[model samples]
Target: MIQRFLAPHRTVAAGMLGRLARRAAVCALAFGIAGAHAQETSSIVIKGKDGWLFPGWGSLTQVDVRGIDNTTRLIGQARDLLAARGIKLEVLLLPDKTLFYEDRLPDGQTLSPEVKARYGLILCKLGQAGISTFDDAAVLRQLKASGQEVFYRTDQHWTQASADATAEAMARMIGRDVAKLDGRPGTGMTLGPLFNERRYGDLAELFLTADEKKQVGREVYSVRRQAESSNLVDDAPAPVHVTGHSMVQPYFGFPQKLSSLIGRPVSVNWNPGNVGPWIVLLEYVESPAFRQQRPQVLVWQMFEPTFAQGPDASGLWDNASIMSANAWLDRLKTALSH
Candidate 1:
């Protein structure tokens, strides 16, 4: 699907370079101070090359092999439990933006060998564990190489185009595994025309000061609108459910795209903050919604950076969301059993 847009390579390349130049100018003016001093201003935001900003939480060189193994084990157990209840678990592990844009890292900042290999390692581990997952990194990389910005320059979330592309890929995977989905005809979503808007990304909004924001300026974002007249019919339960963070929110058009492509209603539950995937999953499965009508396919989306961080990672996840790995599994078991 993404390959179809490659025919306009010249046009897209010109636009891409133009945007890069604008962002580079803005970033240069915004961070006039020395690199070390600029980093001191915001502990949460990492100043990168060409006016790009990254979240500090996702360290470029942090790789915990043990953590990854533990996470894989937990996910495998969760898959078994969900399988028993006839729910097909599809794990969507989103690689960090840095993986794709390492060239844009701040001066002297480079990805360590471990960081470079972490994603592939996790994918291998997941496969070895017999867990069903997809290589989203490969999909995004392909889009990026084709001149499509899969991620925002100053935000942690994915762009609308990337979301649509991913949804298309995920739809293919789901279709192959589930064979069919149960939903009413014409229950899918309709995507409206694409529109462009200039806005400060989350990193800039949260970390940059008023003067800094003005200097950095807002970048143009391509957004897809949901057709105003389109609405999902609630006559039957949604065959698919997506539980994740801000990336999967309606604002980014991920769920809607998935619904439209799958030709079925896709129920979604997402929290903006880093609530952690474990808590997000438990929240959905434990809710009355799950008891009333459980989805046939559960798309559990998680970030690669935090994939290794267990449910009890103190500072990473909120206090309420934190718990022992065993405790989380227990709750999941109870929820599925009920």
Candidate 2:
């Protein structure tokens, strides 16, 4: 009697259950496919030509471009402030890694036309403002043409050779004034033994997986150490001072080589490149180091990307470090008065 009572609806219920199962399976398959695609696309690393890896999100964004005029104005204002203190300001704008390695970029990635013109535009704007600028692009291109690696395959920083070349250029500029002051011809200085080391680049470490790190390998650089010279002393309060990013650090052999080439001891005060240039300059201005050993010429080295963006681009820097263009100029003026 129970079977007869349910038998009429049992067939209809079974049909409905079978259709629902089929629909659930289809939905699951679609979601599974989408999830896999999203995982692949969200990876931070992209494979580049010849086993190189590029950061998927490393390029400059709209915010950086929007802030260029403001950044440039601040730089010019800094020059004016330093000029008031009777100190010379030399702006060294290091070109982006992509500038030298565009051919090795990851597949489907292209440097925008605006980025291609960024360095030249920066130089032009700075020159128009009468700020002393270094032509790093021309020098790097010349080195690259001569088969010297201007930048590492996986790193955002320049090679030791490129750093040395930049130092040499700085030495030439600084040497001229020193020669004029001392009433002597500029002497040809020398560097010591070559030191070799194997290292991983910051970008490589940031983007590569363990397997990729092993596969892509590390870059070896033979850095030049400062030689024991009769003329140069280590402890003197040198007239030339360098303040910038990691590029000017002693590890990269920039200051040492710069000292060797200029025939005099040099001083360097630098920080990690990410802290932004405005903070570095402002802090240096207010520090006891600046008060005790003021430099006759200060070399401010910075990368193009960082130079393009205003201080608050990442919002990672402190309030004391980040401010508007006008505010920064006012602060610079205040710092100079003290």
The CA lDDT of each predicted structure is 0.77, 0.63
Instruction: Quote model 2's TM-score.
Output: 0.77
- Which predicted model would earn the best lDDT? 1
Give the per-residue lDDT of model 1 (tens digit) for 1-338: 01100000010145643553344334323423112110012257888887888887765655666576668778877888899899999998888888888888888988776667667777776766667888999999999999999999989889998999899989998988887787765667766899999999999899999987777679988888657667433344678888888898777888888888887778778775467888888888988878988999999998887787889887778788899999999999999988
Number of the top-ranking candidate, with TM-score as the measure: 1
The residue pairs in collision within model 1 are none
Residue 276 error, candidate 1, Å: 0.5
TM-score of 1: 0.85
Give residue 331's error in model 1 in angstroms: 1.0
Q: Predicted candidate 2: what Cα RMSD to the true structure?
A: 22.7
Over 73-181, each residue of candidate 2 has an lDDT whose tens digit, in order, gives 6676677678779788888888877777778876677766555666776666566556687789999999999999887777666788998889888778775534432
